[model samples]
Target: MSLLTTKEIMEIIPHRQPMLLIDTIEELEPGKRGVGKKCVSYNEPYFAGHFPGEPVMPGVLTIEALAQVGAVVILSCPQFKGKTAYFAAINNARFKQKILPGDVVMLEVEMIKQKGPIGIGKATATVDGKVAVSAELTFAIG
Candidate 1:
């Protein structure tokens, strides 16, 4: 069972359809960490042009999905409620494998440092227990 459904997640963050990448949050620790899930589909708009013959989820979008999970982590904090978490920076991002349709991505983000409105999270996205992407994501809550 999911800790936060898509509807519940929408209540905490401002992301909407198409742009809202995470389908559910499996684990949460308010401002400290979160584990989210995204069910990749062939019908996704990006697949139309990302690659016609063989579609693959873009690395940037995967990063965005992970960041959205991070957003949930920070935005769920009582002090930061009703605020948006913007990407201040993304560092040391590494993409290890292709994320294809019909795969379910497990996104995880752990807030490692924070000061005032700025924070950084260690993020990773995996499929079938294999790492697909990993990065250090910096966010600014506003």
Candidate 2:
């Protein structure tokens, strides 16, 4: 019942159309972790230039999508609701597979550490049971 729809995600994060990477949040554990979904479509504006004919999801955008999911998780923390979380770092980023249009990526994020004003987290994106991207991210939240 607490699932976050696109509208709710919009309220929690500043990202919008074309940049808004998350389509839904199926689970949220304040100060702990989260699970989100993004269904890529052929109509995405970036698809055209990402490839001339054989469009492939960019590694950076895939990581960004994962980060956006992490952002939602950070904001869901009871103490941080209504605030913004900024990216501080993303380590060990890896793109193991190519993500194409029409793939529904399942993004999962887990909070690993929260100290002072910074947070450390890990995120991974999977499509069809295969990992497309993964990274450890750190954020400085105000």
Per model, how many backbone clashes are there? 0, 0
Q: Which stretches of candidate 1 lie over 4 Å from their true place?
A: none
What tens digits encode model 2's per-residue C-alpha lDDT throughout 72-132? 9888777888888888998999989999999999999999998977989888999998998
- lDDT per residue, candidate 1, 15-110, as tens digits? 998899999999999889999999999999999999999999999999999999999999999999999999999999999999999999999999
All candidates: TM-score: 0.99, 0.95
Best by the lDDT measure? 1
CA lDDT for candidate 1 = 0.97
